[model samples]
Target chain A: MPPFKDLFKGKQKYVTVKPTSIQTEQPDGLWTKCTQCGQLTYTRELAHNLLVCHKCGFHFKLSAAQRLAITLDEGSFVEFDSNLVSADPIEFPGYAAKLEKTRQATGLEEAVVTGQGTIGGYPVMIGVMDFSFIGASMGSVVGEKVARLFERATRQHVPVVMFCASGGARMQEGVLSLMQMAKTSAACARLSEAGVLYVSVLTNPTTAGVLASFASLGDIIIAEPGALVGFTGQRVIEETIRQKLPPGFQSAEFVLEHGMIDMIVERRDMKKTLASLLALHERRHEAG
Target chain B: MINLTLDFEKPLVELEKRIEELRNFSREKEIDLSEEIATLEKKAEMLRREIFDNLTPWQRVQIARHPRRPTTLDYIGLIFDDFIELHGDRVFRDDGAIVGGIASLGGRPVTVVGTQKGRDTKENLARNFGMPHPEGYRKALRLMKQAEKFHRPVVSFVDVVGAYPGVEAEERGQGQIIARNIEQISRLATCIVVVITGEGGSGGALAIGVGDRLLMLENAYFSVISPEGCAAILWKDGSRAQEAADVLKLTAPDMKRLGIVDEVLPEPLGAAHKDREGMARIIKDALIRSIDELSGIPPRRLVERRYVRLRRIGEFMIREAAQEGFAEAASAGGDVLRATGPAGPKGEAKR
Candidate 1:
């Protein structure tokens, strides 16, 4: 979730009902390449499969909205802070409006969405990020909200599940944003040590500042299919080393294989998987 | 002429084909096609599940890194109660790599330490990809010590490739910070349990690695060096990483057998990414067991046992082939060595 040159990321509303086979005497479907597997995958096919390469099993790019769909129960999700906004405390050129545009474009208040919901009939705390929202940056509000969420979850005695998608600290918010990582992580740490079930789902593009803080502090980590789950992208590493990346570098599978992730799952199974997992957490708690 | 781009319109593909055929049969301008569009909408329901049935590891990584994947802040929304975030490594500049605070874990006071990676370009630069600097490690040490002071056990989730290696990080004494953690964590009296919830790499991992019990997620990895780095070192080419991984024996199954780790928390077949709840439950159970085990022992014993266990890493391993000759000779009636000689047990040697 860096300055990903994407404009209409999450809020790219479709004029058509859904992105089905829509051809109007013109070809609007774009040609995309799967960087990991190095195969020619149609944008539509990759999109249909939730950014996973059917042939090579490489995970494609994703945003927060996509994650909510994959993890939450169908029709059970209620987005929070659709209107919360970020001000240009740094006054970086065009940053304020940029935040506005990003908010509108991603359909999110800031970068994160904290809510109360159920994955499989198990009421739990939920936090999802939208990388498109200024690269899913963490700022004061983001941190504050996270801290509040943890406190709330502990109060409810419900397990908390967080999907981590961050570029790290929010630079635009300056030091204030950076502080949020500590604050939020601290909140998570308390919940975890107390023996409350804290499940963290590491998602695509988790890196940098975020990786150093709460994102890395999950009790249980789960990943989605074919995500780029590293703090440093292959591009940066390649540039640093002045060499080409190896096959499957930085992909979720590579991370999983490297022991960076707990599990790799398809989007369809995320809900049921979470439910069963939550059930087990309760059992463990009882036994404990 | 299949449109791979048309995943949402499988029925449309057929309808469009029929429309084409009809047009071929009668080229009059009196056909309306809007009616057929409505009929093709039903299959979209099933397609949702159809596309996400089975995901691959690479795909799962993507999900794990999805910009939309939840963040720590989001978790705050869903987990924990009465959470308060404390600041400053209580040192120079506050390190962002490690986050710790006071919060209730199952309504009990506990301290937590975890790595944080950023989601975007600028943030990534700032956080250094969850790679802690000396201060981050120090801050974690500070918080953990505080927990120990309160007689509260510490919980840590490890996820990082290593400590930051930037020039600034080096100047800040990253090594010193991590070394201090090793010293402090080893002697701390309170129970300590660590979970390799994600990537556990390098000394950055070791900074929080000194604990009473270590649990790793099923697919999570713990290694001295990343496979890619190892490949680069051995083959002078990072591309041979897969071959290195095949030989590294760094996976949970291998590590568990090696006794380097205590337990491998089982993830759903594909991974914990699919089953967050299941993963959470496993961690909770593991945490309880780990705490119970650690708490059972006296504090002094806890410290000594952990130290001895770490020191005894290679105790279980021996060069069988190299020693086989000497062992066999002794077994075959060669003079037995010191303590237990050939007259005692077979293969007993003084050398």
Candidate 2:
């Protein structure tokens, strides 16, 4: 619940001159004001409750694992491409070492974790993007892993549900990372063409090249209660065009009301809804 | 009663608080609150149904655009197998809007393409609200070509609002890209099937709109321009978009009647959002049959049929127009020319 003032300033953890890993050890007491109620809360408590604030009912940043555990059936997830990693295809200065450090710290090979699991007893494929990993950027490896998951699901003829949490395309991969968006989307398209049900779940803070590509092509789109959903951040968009956002702009529920998604699923109901849809799709196999 | 509590211990506490408050109030022996609670519950259910059933076109637009509405990623999990995502337009930058790759469609090898929108804020910033830039169109054209080359049928799920209109998109030649997609897809030597799965507005929709058989979901609307854009131009106001939508005949029934769409797939009683599986099956059937029909067509016939379809599109319009006023113009012109002894000025004849 840090004030968006710092985010507005774009104070990122970029070390342009140093190629070493920025292990930002806690510089201050790991607690701050709630984004909703301005109540001071401990960071670890929020982390334990899946980034959801206890007092003000505010949701904070969620790790990919936290998202998967919340979404999948109890102990049913099996991760795919856990070893697949991202390379600095763009050669952005200091990006590769930064990626390595983030990789080690997050214990995730790539930004996305493709999991095969049951949500409400229905067999489905789920991919959760971890923003902790390079802003949960979409890269070639992420795309490939996603595409492979799609292929697997298509072969299995089951439904796919992706939880997208990204900062758009990974700049470190340069055009290669950008290509991941199209590639991943193409894989989703194949799933759709094959008559397999594919639904995209947009999570908190999805943006950039990833949104432009495949994040929106869902059979039944779902978003977390208060996730930010838009093409650009408010500040950057304002700076670029010097225009103010309409009231309630870019929130998940607002986007839903605006006709962008199907439902604003609570953190709890996502799995059950997914399972019911999958089971129904299985019974109603009308494809040639 | 079955426990409605699934997760979030806090909500349970809040509900319990309300329940205790109600019990205490009712236990006073003077007032019976159970009836009020039941009435309120009934009212809530009725309101939910009314809201779900009576969604306006604008509200439907919102539903079609709900941020949480599942995206292509969700579908891949529900469907598809071993999807090897291909990259690059083979000529320029890869466009994120047009997603294309190889995968099995109901156990058959097929090339797939879809326009993707983002779910959260950062991804939407990246995906550009599911609008394909020129590069996105080019990428689709390449995928269609690959499908044709391999004799694999192509299935495209189109849901873009339109091509990106940014300076970057213009600089990348948006018009040329759209024109080229029209040209290539019209003559692409593969059985192409397109589904207007969602918005399907403008060229972003048409980039994938060309196909041997075009299908649209009941709740899905496809049009030459968005209703708002259409209204703004036709009525000089954007608010009349709903009327424009009704008259423009941009719905599935309208498009089907106009022969612009091959089939109007039915959703559930409410909408596809209510019955995602039902809608998926409708699409799957349309895709499978269209692919079956287009797959066995000879390469020459495949391209020829498409060309013929395009060439034949305006036959009714041309014929109808000819009958309505062209005949009178021809007759009048003949008389005028004869009266002038066939030596009239060329510019005067045009008038």
Candidate 3:
């Protein structure tokens, strides 16, 4: 058999730019390069445009705080289960150290932050995944937080809005991380049965286990423009198939053509879209 | 018989090879070496049986992924009759990774679906190495629902590492399709028999895995993630897969013991690859028997039983101290929380 490296020699086609902590830290007075277009723009200008590239319309990854600040009504967010953190039951080597480092680097308790917030003054449950927090991988904590968020939302009679931005299951927790896909999915199943509206906003790079779970179970699914949403990595698929991928295979536009997502809303218009949806659902609930 | 022999089966392969060499030499020389050849054959057979009987979890995983192993289509051809394959997820193009159709298993009509990995490189590419996309899953669900409507039993052969992890698959609601399949399959008004034919990895496997009676081939493995994925996550090294396999308890025997699988259908002599016909017979008999047994029950009861079966898997005892600590904390906070006003903590109404 040929060497493994020989099979995938020149197949790394997609250029994924890993956003640094420094780029996300201040969000002002700095120049950031658009991963898709390679055009640099002032950070303050990017923030004013909701971190979307002015030139090529590329959507940058958002932190959980930034997502909540933009989507939710002012000062209306009430977080739930904030203290829940993974205990690393498998005792994975360097897992504790890595979690500590990520915590310090991102200033977040876990990859996902779940809470109750008002979207256009309509009660809704929100769970936002921060891509900067260890690639926003779903571990037990992320799963539990999302599950509990849905449970609370169901009891309180509110719609759910989740911003999905993940790089699959967290590896540190091993099988525990994988099980989260099922656990969170089961919770979403219950929420669906309860007749609660779930609007899943697929941000840049939502793939693997999370994509297979609650992220896909939305009543009204939306995505940011040019966001990469898929289960397998592009490079892995190319290597396995030994073929060239079509242009924009995993992008939001490609997904829309495939009829996976309902619509692609720009970052600046995301709040308006979500608010309109919330109001529409509120009217339905009142009449029904 | 195949050239793809595993590490543990090296001795058996070598002995078999020697026996073949002696047979060829005897035929060429026109000499009487039949007695010696017979003795060597007996020894080889014994060695093969012994080695197969004591396989470790990692070895079973290897056998499950063996290139020569009979795949879903192979089993369908051998065991079932009139397999008319249905294609395409109505909303999108058909996915070749997962194949399903109406077929007759032992003269009983059933809807059959399974992940199809390729034998050669070309076929593997076409089938996406049996890692299904959202359309693949949606296709399976559609066929299952069709079976449900027709009051036919459903039998799915599982052999996938997981769902496809591509950007297109995710955009197409891969997770939602799989999760919905699980939810809908559980409540389907028909007997469902799931046969774990090969690698049953994670949610990808479980997407089409729900059934009243779950059967597994002796060498088949089912786990949340592949051993390599687990090793990479835990040890930061993919080489620790063997250790991960041992700890994951993903082998058929382990699954049977853990109540994840109803029965373990024993493979012939050296494993499924050595005797595809024999393996097919065993699987066919198991599926027919399980379906017959399940057919007598009402649809509601079968659905309830399936729910219980899934809920019971991976159930374990949490640490007593942790349980008590959590309960105590909850009780301590419950009173104060109840005493608070109707207004929420952040000044929002409680609704």
Candidate 4:
């Protein structure tokens, strides 16, 4: 073969490719687009980076399965309550259809996946919420699973770890959704009374009813680097206050400054951070 | 206080006005009009019943938000003795939206906490329109904890439009504070009696709302989200609040039917605003009865009962039967399986 430089100089046929065309032409699942920065990344590379944006560091939302696969020790998770699904207590209009469609799309029985798992050799009763399933809103099934997780952890004297990602309570279930806050909180109280450790990890867009319940009741609350964590939505706050919010209002960094969370851990270091914290608590418990 | 009136109450108000006018005319003319007045009075009573007896959920919502409705302070003034108002969360400023204190209910010492709304513009501003912040919940939590230590039962009156949706509220960790209150209140050694006096709005109300016995006024509404909010989200039109209200199942009777509330105390004709003292008297009796019943249970049992009561509030179904049913339905080319009544052997959905 001729020299590469010589070939390029002799027959320079430049084909200009537009970035938008490149994005559109690629197969759908091959590239993951960063929601915050609009940066295109190879899907496999992004997955390898724990779904954090390679360029902008935006933490993409994860499904409960993905969360379990990354956070738990390989093949260590034994799922719990995979059979529980929602019932329309009030017979909300169109709710059944919506639930059916969401279940079909996500293949999740409910918004939350609860299980007993080993995270870096420390066994924990864990529950991870998938926001894709109805915004991971705490309805009847979600509440029961979480309450059972805490109850089981209390009984077993095992530490519990929960990954919370929700918009709020499910509106379709009406006040039944609201009562889940109390249900989950009561379970959390029992866990605390039993003196079993509970660590809550908040992911992107944790707000409203879930935040006001067990998600906020964690003994040690950890947040992803850029998670939107707060009691109310930003638009609702702006409408109520009749003013613009300052930059970084409900971001993880802002919440840290306000002393709401224990720490902000990046996705890359989340497993290590969680393992260390669990080890510390275990050591302390043994010493005590 | 501004005399706010609902559209449905217009005919009742006009009838009352006519009755007053007739009395004035009889006095002015010095004529015997007793027979005519009695007939008119009977007509008015019928009209009142016809109007108030069949109130729609939307109408009750209006009553719950009525400016002239009895407030927390009004109930406190009428129902309790020696109501000394407590102040502050000690972590932050005292929230005027929520008021808490120690008082005697039928001669028994109890802790009282409530979300307070104001009668006028300035007072409403001071009260933040009864929407609490983190500090408000913290203050309620502090008082409840005190109640636990002192062995006094806790009585919380819920009448809020939800926690304040504001920046400072979030910055101060509103969610965490509310969560802490619910957790702490659930395990408080003292009995808790929460009354939904007016608008029991979402987690704001539930922050201090978990208790052994929950009583609600006939016209009061306890909702997950406001009708307006629900309407706006579901139908994309806030004006469809009436439909949302009808669907929310938030009225006292609805809650009672759902097994969420222990009792639905009747309101006076024309709702609580018409006879504040009468409404307070009704609530007083309910509180005394609830406190007495809850007080009989030991502290540990009280906590356990609370846990069980709360644990039973959700509705869901098991997937094994559902999946099997789905398989059958799919094979038969029929509809998806529907839950009959939250049936499961695990007792997770026991009513």
Best by TM-score: 4
Report the Cα lDDT for residue B153, model 4: 95
* Candidates 1 and 2, the one with greater TM-score: 2
Error of 1 at A207 (Å): 0.4
Model 2, position A172: C-alpha lDDT score: 41
**Candidate 1 residue runs with Cα over 4 Å from true position:** A1-48, A81-83, A232-245, A283-288, B1-351
The residue-by-residue lDDT of candidate 1 on A155-229, one tens digit each, is: 777788888776555544433443344355546655765678888777666655566556666667787765655
Top lDDT hit: 4
- Model 4: per-residue lDDT, tens digit, A1-288? 111112113111212123665567764435555656767676656666766778988777776667777788766777777789889999988889889998887667788988887878999999998876877888999999999999999989999999997778888898899999999999998898888899999997687899989999999999998888888776677667789888778889999999999999998799899999899888352553
- Which runs of model 3 end up more than 4 angstroms from their true locations? A1-58, A87-97, A100-107, A172-179, A241-248, A283-288, B20-46, B54-58, B77-97, B104-108, B118-135, B161-183, B201-204, B223-250, B253-263, B292-351
Candidate 4 runs further than 4 Å off: A1-29, A283-288, B1-3, B321-351
Candidate 2: stretches off by over 4 Å? A1-32, A42-49, A284-288, B1-351
Clashes of 2: 79
lDDT of 1 by residue, B206-227 (tens): 6787677888776666654455
Q: Give me the candidate number with maximum DockQ.
A: 4
- Report the TM-score for the A-chain of model 1: 0.78
In model 3, state the lDDT of residue B244. Answer: 81
lDDT of 3: 0.76
Q: Relative to the unseen true structure, what is the C-alpha lDDT of residue A123 in candidate 2, on a scale of 0 to 100?
A: 77
List the lowest-lDDT window of 10 residues for candidate 2 chain A.
A10-19
In candidate 3, how many Å is residue A85 off?
3.8
Residue-level lDDT tens digits of model 2 in B1-351: 324222222343454566667777888866889887676555555655665555555545545555555565445444567787887787778766667799988899988888888867677777777888777888888888988889888888888776664535533545445544664566677788888777866445765777778888766776545666545534557687666565444566656765567888776654565566666666677777777877777877876566445433311001122113211222231132212111100000000
List TM-score (chain A only) for every prediction: 0.78, 0.83, 0.88, 0.89
The model with the greater lDDT, 1 or 4, is: 4
